[model samples]
Target: MAHTTSHAAPFLSRAGILVLFLAAQMLALTAGAAPYLGPEDEPIRLNANVTVTGSDVRLGDLFSGHPDHEEKVVAAAPAPGQRMVLDTDWLTNLARTYGIEWHPADAYDRAIVYRSGRTVTPSEILAAFKDDLVTKGMPANTGLAPGAPLPTLTVPSEANPPFSVREAFFDPTTKNFSAVAEFTGPEGQSQFLQVRGTGFNTVTVPVLKSDVTRPQVITPDMIVSAEIPDGTLKHDIIVDAENLIGKSPITFLRAGQPVHDTEIARLNLVDVPVLRNDMNREDIIGENNVTWLTVDANTLPPDAVTTAPYLIGKSPRHIVAGGTPIRRGDVIAAQQEIMAVASRDLPLGEAFRSGDVDWVPVGEDSIGAGVIVSEADITGRVTTRPIRAGQPIRAIDVTRPTVIPKDKLVTMIYATPIMTLTVRGKALEDGAAAQTIRVANANSNKMVLAEVVDADTVRVVSQQSAMR
Candidate 1:
């Protein structure tokens, strides 16, 4: 009716208005759509549906095991919030009229983790959400409308198992089955089972570990693999030998008296060659109850102890009375005073102690100088290596000397480089490989029955010949 102001429609404004109006209309429709009712025989919601989702999808699968599932409806996802709180006031009213109480499950205290497919009504969803919220550790009474989308609740997994074996058994005669089952429960859920065994093996294989490349597990079930004892051990001993106190009497003689072959018969002391059979290891060297004879008295100078064998102007006896006696070694003691009667040196002079000594003998000279004995003298074998004129007489220094008692028999010839040798022959009496046999100064006697050890050696000893 009048010149209206030229103004174009504001598209943005119009569109916004349209959107607002549409939203208002939708809200009004949704609001007026339905309400919680007390009407008998009525559904909580009319013709509406719901859905739910969360980290625990299996939780939904587990829901199939819930009770009265038919009466329950899976609704849409609730708005993002914790808890599956139910409006007890509203549900109670509905139950008063419909005779159905939507009380929580026995495990209601625990939050229900929603999987992608789990859904329920607003009230039910609220209750479930509240249950999920509270049980899932969320505060209670959290509000959630019908279209509220629920968050994915995380479900707990199993913890590391303890190092415990379930059962053990021992039996090998029967075929039987025995086992222990392993399982995992809900975060707070727990259970246990102990199984007694019957008809089991005394040895059985153990459970193999996954990470280990090698498998080594032995159990008590394999009887065929058991170890058996073969037998027990026993020991016995026989009388080999003992010390003899000379079945005859001992006659003492003057220290330096030389005995001709004729005088030996009249004398009591016998000059028997010391042999292995004659002396136990304990006798010469001494052990246990056997005492080491005083070499000091046994091999004193001709004038001191062995006057029976000393030769005048030839050699002085070199034996001791208070020292260990050797079978073929040298001896030292108070000759003039301190003196050494070595196998090669017959030292004569004063007294000797630890300090006045210059040289000493080391054992049988068997192995690289055996154990050396201090404050002790030697007495074994003494054969001269060489000799010189005016030299003090000694067993090891004499070259070609004759015994005064030439009438007495020479029983043995030691490692002699010359013809008068003690040869070891062939084996006899089964295992006997060697016997003592003496060779004449010039004869290579073949009639001699000597068992041989080495081709060129023999021991100078005879029991049968002596008895004959």
Candidate 2:
């Protein structure tokens, strides 16, 4: 073990200080007597670009100096990008001014040469870029978003180059900024780089007021709103305090932590049915085949069917597995019903009554479009063909209520303001009640438009038009 102690800097006596001053004065006089007779100093070897590390730099360190001799010549740190030469003549003049009695050796004419001593670090480049943004009206708190790229500072590793910010453009619409930087080396070589970053704005949002180690229900009083600078927040963050009420966290939320949408879900949920057994295509679902489950309403799809009535009578177009969600595509409408199933089956040419046909819902698309008959359209109508109880009603199964038969004799009445005349006529086309059709008058053998009144009777216009 070694002893260690602290001490102050050693102080020189007043007599010793005067002795040093007189010795320096005597050396200056001796140096003036001998014009070039002094210690031989080698030339200082400096690169084209040199970076000065400190303010007080000894001039003797740059060139060869004796180990025993003291050098009093000092120089201040040079500014960035300042270029200058330290040739033999310049060095000699600097030594003369400082009373430095030394000269460069005859064999070496050059002393020290310096071109540029600028050290542009990555941090310095970034600071300058930020300063440029501030001069152009950027906010003090403005910065790059998390994970944003750093400035592309590609200065030479071997030398420090002069750097300047050429342009810093910002676009408010896109919330992005770009910068162009130019770097010049000592030998006049130049380089440029373009850097970009996304701009973010600081905002205030509600945060949990206390730490929650386990998943707990959130309440309005448990949170407080605060302002903070954030660039990594998700897009669907919950910023309002009211939105936090009656919500349960999926994970633990620490105190003063900002609330996000993914962390919590609303406690209010709706109960919907899920299939318990596999449902085949066109199979009508029943109440007993499904089980109810509670799910968050926000998580449900917009077209999700929630009620049992919507699925009970509806038929599926595809097979639905058990435990799967019952959606729009899994079910078909229960509007298609068979007419004959409502009543006892009727034979061909039998008149159909409201009680004679059944309107039971079926799980088939056999009824073509536009041809589906409703109860009002089929009441008191006769079926043209044999009817099956479970078969869907078709257009060909029923005929129109024909009041007049084709090619049949009919009484055509011609009425006038004063009197009415009746004549025999033949029906050219089958006509229903109040239907207009062509009828040939038996007496004149001329076809005329007439309205069918009954099964065997028709009426013409006034006597003036009927006569023509």
Best by TM-score: 2
Clashing residue pairs, backbone N/CA/C < 3 A, model 2? 341-358, 342-357, 342-358, 343-358
Instruction: In model 1, state the lDDT of residue 335.
Output: 22
Error of 1 at 39 (Å): 17
Q: Which residue ranges in model 1 land beyond 4 Å of their true spot?
A: 5-42, 45-179, 183-190, 197-468
- Candidate 2, overall lDDT? 0.66
What would the TM-scores of all predictions be? 0.15, 0.32
Candidate 1: tens digits of C-alpha lDDT, residues 124-199: 3234333433444332322223222433322222233411223322223432223232222232233332232322
Model 2, span 1-468: residue lDDT tens: 122222222233556788999999999998666533225644333222334433333555443433332244455534333434456776677667644555666534553323234455555665667678878887755654423445433333334334778788666777687886787533336767677776667677888888864335677678887655666566777778888887877667778878778888755567888888888866778888889877666667888888878888777777888775678877887556553352566688787765676566544564545444576666656778887765656657776578898999999988867988788989999987777888888877788888989998898843334433
